[model samples]
Target: MATLRIGIIMHGVTGRMGMNQHLIRSIVEIRKQGGVTLANGDRLLPDPILVGRNAERIAALARQYGIERWSVDLDKALANPDDTVFFDAATTQARPALLKRAVQAGKHIYCEKPVATNLAEALDLYRAARAAGVKHGVVQDKLWLPGLRKLQLLNDAGFFGQVLSVRGEFGYWVFEGDLQPTQRPSWNYRSEDGGGIILDMLCHWRYVLDNVFGKVRSVSCLGATHIPQRWDEQGKPYRATADDAAYATFELENGVIVQLNSSWCVRVRRDDLVTFQVDGTHGSAVAGLTDCWTQSRVNTPKPVWNPDVRQTHDFFDDWVKVPDTTVYDNAFKVQWELFLRHVAGEGEFRWNLLEGAKGVQLVELGLQSWKERRWLDVPELTGREGA
Candidate 1:
């Protein structure tokens, strides 16, 4: 009967991902749709105040998005009693302190992945939010991806009997800013600036593995800075102190082995920039960002691997495409609506700060496994003693 307006403080949305995905695609689209419809037939509208260190950039973004509220001072923004939610998509090193400040300000928290640089900090952030008695969530956008959703459906339907392993190839060449401008921020290749493929992507693998297929039990990873020299945004040359490539092997609890290669130096040769091939006893499927192809045991083609003779196998023809029977929305926007509903007492939100901390734990173990040159077991995480 009445509109439920939720005030949200949106910080660090002046950057690429913050500006594109979170601001324009998710929040703006939500506002365009006239807000999220609640279970009781009421709509929950988000009133966002954009905040950033760059006043000019922030103001430009606000005006472009038709948002009236904008601020450069985070403290002043947090002081607004009307705003109950704080969302951050900023640099990894700055996320903890910002989220902590928001928690202290009695604002609910939602943030991007790798919650902190390390496991302890991530857990502490979760603890701070818990102590403040504020609702919290993390961005686990891949769960709703259309291709992965199809994989989930097939897995749920027992389409792949006795799953064996998953192999993921994710990457495309990012320019070094010499001849071609770099697509990623220069900070992404600097370790001191919270840069590295392992730190950046392992958290994603942690959740995707646990939620989609099975819980990861152990990890073996090797990191490399394939491109040592890179140019920054200003075209200044600098030594890349971070690993641009990560070769990780994860053993899931169900005995499924997952090998994922994440790199910024490799060329794209697959169906998509990122693809996951799931092989099982009865069937197999390969999924990209938007499409998934499956090949049943009955339909699989027989190929002879003979170096002596050139055989025309037509290797890619055996698999059939998966249809989208259900309509899908933007992954980030879908999660946003779910979190907003959870904050408004719709239901339990499972992907909280604690879940996010688990991702950080995986990152820690992944780096340790690489450093020690051995597989490290992932110990089960629990809440702080006696809560």
Candidate 2:
């Protein structure tokens, strides 16, 4: 069998999402499974070099994952001709400069969402990558999620005839790090450090809305910093200047209305940490991170409002659980395999740098909407591949 070893520079992987999702669950898992197979009987094997600020921590991570390479010098890694692909999962604020350098070095680029703090930088990065003629991509892992996959299947099957509206509820109570240790990093709460719920989650929402439902036309958003004070990793008190919660509404090109509520200040009472409910003319479905439940028009139950008495009906019993007909792999891993194939010229990759810029545009517009207290039109980004 023909084996193609592809060198990849993995940067900012010391962070939680970078370490767990990109490295361990995706890349390492691919290695464990003998790499991605091609149709022409060749296998594309990834050779990843971990790049981070802390040598000791990165070295430990590399050793733990059975990786042979680890480096703290990004310039050294970029100088190597063998490492053709540069993957960044670094802080959002640092992404633009890192990507610019990688693109200048003529390396294929892949990275996490919110490509930049604003739309201009994001578009600039995209343009630079396009000018360099390097393969580029952004992470839209939610589309590969099992629950969302099921929703896609249902849409494909025409289960939701003339899909009407979508409601997304995401996030949960993140401890203030005063008494209980915070689950998320301290940087996520600092605006100067590129921290905020809108910047972080809106990117995910934009992709999900565009790919699954329809292209977003306009947006209305309201943001809040519910918990003003919190403790950092060092157990010291700090003012949380960044917004922790967002209530947003989107109007799609297809006339579908979408309302999304994202917050870290609220407690979870839903089926999962994040849940989406879609209602159509013929049916409705609720999807969590890994599960989906559907209720058809025929199965819809009629209920009478009685505010004076306790309701006896179990409202949750009407929807039927969607079954998993096929085994699902890790969402990030699935995307990674696709990217590998795309790089090898075996598949098409639509989620490119321009798509990432669209996500950044949504975040920028959302922030503008919040500030102006009015609906903002999501203008189409110019200078894309087709445009």
Candidate 3:
């Protein structure tokens, strides 16, 4: 059997997302499953070189993963003939240059979103990859989320007729690390680190809206930095310059409205870290990452406000929980398998750099809306002409 050995330059593999999601959950899990079996009876296995600046961390991760190849120098890895793909999970500020170099090096590209901190850099990355004739993709993990899939199915089945609006509530209190250590890195609270709820989450919202609701036409956003100060890993105090919370309203092309509230300083008492309640003329549905509850107008009872008498209605009981029929793995892993299939010429990769650019575009308009204190129009990306 001929081996289709694919080498990946995995930058920022030491970080949380890199360590947990990319390395442990996706790639390691894939390998443990005996790799992806092709229809031709061939197997596709990734030979990823863990790349980072810290030697001790790299060594520790290498030992943890049982992988031999590791590198501190990115240039050397990028120059390697064996490395066919460059995967970036680095900070947003570092992604543009890294992606440009990778494209110029003639490697396939896959990275976490928003691709870049701004639209121009994100657009440039797409154009460069296109010009270099290399396959490019971005992580749109939410599209593959299990609970959301059921919501999509319900929408497709017309369980929610003439969709009216969507409300997304996502957040959990991030410890200041003064008394309790923060779960996320301190960089996530600094603007210089490309850390803001609006930039980070609106990218996800764009894909969700495009995939589930409708194409977003305009947005009005309000951003806030509720947690003004925080402590780093070492107990050093730093001001939280980036926004920890964002309240945004988007108007879709289909005239359906979306109200999203994202926060890192709020308490979580909901079903999941993220909950989306989508309402239509006929019914409503609420979905988290793993569970979905829905109710149609047929099952909904009409009610009127009465101050004289006690109301008799079982609102929460009216909604029915949607059973999970399809098995689900990690959201990003599902996308990864699809991307691998796409790269192998077995299927199409719809979530390309252009789709990533749309995400960047939405974030840009959202920032604009926040700054200008007015609704802003979202312009189409260069590659979204026919889309």
Candidate 4:
């Protein structure tokens, strides 16, 4: 079989999401699987060059993953003619400028979400990529999640007939680094470094709601910095200026109401770290990251609430687990494969930079809602074709 080698410059891959999800789990896994086969009998092989600030770290990553190329100089990597694709999973503050440079070099761009810290910058990146006439995409990996995919399947089968509302609970307590080390990077709790739960997670919820349920029409949000002090990577204490938690409500254009609670301070007591409960007229399904439990209207149990007596009913027993019908790959890897195929002119990719901008817009509105203490209307982002 003929092999078409596609060169990719992976930047900021030394970071947590970048290293684990994009590089090791996705690209390395694809390489291990003998590359992606196309319909025309040609296989697409990825030749990724790890790019980062630290030479030693990048070299170690390359050696660990069997990657042939590693570079500390991003400009030199971008200047190479063979590297047609540029992927970034860097901090939100550095994204716009990095993407701009990539688009100028005429490279196809794919990146982690919250494409920019603000809607204006996010829109600028989309416009630039469009003007450069390059293929572009952003990570909305939740759309490919198994549980959410099951929800989509159920929705398609009319299991959730006339959906009325959606409730999403996402978050887990992160150590404050005093007694135990912090699980997340300290920059995540600093506003100067583009850290905040609203900016970080609202982007995710926006796409999940828009694609899975309906387009978000408006939003009302309240934010809090639950842990005011946390230790950094160097074991130094720092004041947390960014919000660690957010309670947000969204109104969908299709009349479905959505509520999401995202935090790094709250403990997880649900089926998974994240769960979405979709309530409909005929049935209801509660989906975690990897599992879904559904309860049909017929299976719904009726009970009267009485504070005086001890409750005997087991509420969890009423729902039936959704069976796994097919093998599922890593969500990030699935999106990466589709992006590679799209870059190769195989099919359409709807989640472009414009969609990324929409996510940022939601983040902006959510913050505005928090500040104003009222609901904010989410206006449509116009001027881009197929936006």
Compared with the true structure, all predictions reach lDDT values of 0.93, 0.94, 0.89, 0.94
Between candidates 3 and 4, name the one with more favorable TM-score: 4
Ranking by lDDT: 2, 4, 1, 3
Range of the 10 consecutive residues with the lowest summed lDDT in candidate 2:
378-387
lDDT assessment of candidate 2:
0.94
After TM-score superposition, what is the CA distance of residue 299 in candidate 3 from its true location, in Å?
A: 1.1
List, residue by residue over 241-357, the lDDT tens digit for candidate 4: 999999999999999999999999888789999999999999999999999999999999998989999999999999999999999899999999999999999999999988998
Q: Write the per-residue lDDT of candidate 3 for residues 1-387, one digit (tens) a residue.
A: 444667788998788998899989998888778677777878788788999999999988988998779989989999998889899998989999999999999999999987999877887888889989999899999988988998999999998889999999998999999988899899989998899888899999999999988999999999999889999999999999999999999999999999999999899998899999999989899999989999888987677888999877767788899998978889988888877767777777989998988988888888888898999988766663432
Among all windows of 10 consecutive residues in model 4, the one with the lowest summed lDDT is 378-387
Query: Of the pair 2 and 3, which is ahead by TM-score?
Result: 2
Candidate 1 achieves a global lDDT of 0.93
For every model shown, the clashing-pair count is 0, 0, 0, 0
Residues 281-343 of candidate 1 have per-residue lDDT tens digits of 999999999999999999988776799987767879889999999899999999999999998
Tens-place lDDT per residue, model 2, 1-387, is 988999999998899999999999999999998899999988999999999989999999999999999999999999999999999999899899999999999999999998999888898898999899999999999999999999999988999999999999999999999889999998898898899999999999999999999999999999999999999999999989899999999999999999999999999999999999999989999999999999999999999989999999998999999999999999999999999999999878999988999988989899999999999999887746333
TM-score of 3: 0.96
How many residue pairs clash in model 1? 0
Give the per-residue Cα lDDT of candidate 1 at 180.
89
